[model samples]
Target: MAKALPEFAPLSLKELRSLWKKYRGNEDIERLVLEVQFSRGVINEVDDYFKIIHRTWRQENLGELIAIEKLRLVLVKQHLRQTVLAEIKPAPKGTKPSEPPEPEPALVD
Candidate 1:
């Protein structure tokens, strides 16, 4: 029989953002290089830009970018909702609960 894998918690917003930044930052750096090349007239043709960017200039990239952005918005909304709920239902004050009074002794026969 296969062993069961341990359950893992979902990634927090901070973790997700860190991961996104680590990946997207590299892509952004590459894109900036391309942008500079274009500005300096180093890349004259669309084909050259595509070749340098290591992509075939497909519209799929734009669609994926939009989808990822939309997912980010949803994550933000959920986080905000959870925050509001937590604030709205704050925990009870830190007071020691009083003990119940001792039961009265049974009446003598």
Candidate 2:
């Protein structure tokens, strides 16, 4: 007999909804929102944060650039995860139904 693979439990819609609501009103939420709106092309927040840290490091020599880089990587990953979750969560109850899906692309002759 073949062994069974481990079962994976996906998060409930309610839990995802709650998580989405918890972060929606936060000022930091705006960063993720901007990222999604811009289709991940913009990096203003990340660039600004790095610039400030770089300036501080230059003046104080308090930490190495590698340390700052590590921190920035962690923050960027977190922002991406939150943005994806927010996008996936369903809209609130009583809202109008969403529009129909976009038409499929046509093949070129």
Candidate 3:
């Protein structure tokens, strides 16, 4: 039987821009964005997007990067699927201990 591929909901343009802002200085995320640009043959569009961001200091230019091209959007969503899920996943809900655990007593021979 063929292995089932995981399904990821498509990310909206807004979400992609938000991700760019949230992880702006992360090298890994920046690399992923470049990979998506190359993989989708949208290098020029992505470059122009970066220029706009550089000029205005606005992260929302990331949205414009994929907005003009549907294929770019699809490629970006696929590349960033894992990152998006990780960022938006809820934190585990549990109470913390009131006090730190005491260090184990030192063993003496």
**Candidate 1, 1-109: lDDT as tens digits:** 9998785443433443444455665777546544533332321232233333333224345334564445446545543443353222222345222322232222111
lDDT of each: 0.38, 0.48, 0.46
Over 4 Å off, model 3: 1-4, 37-109
Tens-digit per-residue lDDT, 8-87, candidate 3: 57454345556667788898986765454344334334434544444453445544434445644654564455336434
Top model number, lDDT: 2
Candidate 1 local lDDT, residue 64:
43
Expressed as tens digits, the lDDT of each residue in 1-109 for candidate 2 is 9998784443333443454467766767645444343432234344445656667787996766787878778666644543454333322345322332232222111
TM-score of each: 0.22, 0.29, 0.30
**Model 3 superposed RMSD (Cα):** 18.6
Question: TM-score of model 1 relative to the true fold?
Answer: 0.22
**Candidate 1: C-alpha RMSD after superposition:** 27.8
Worst 10 residues of 2 by lDDT: 100-109
Candidate 2 at residue 16, lDDT?
38
* Model 2, residue 106: C-alpha shift (Å): 44
Residue pairs clashing, model 3:
none
Ranking by TM-score: 3, 2, 1
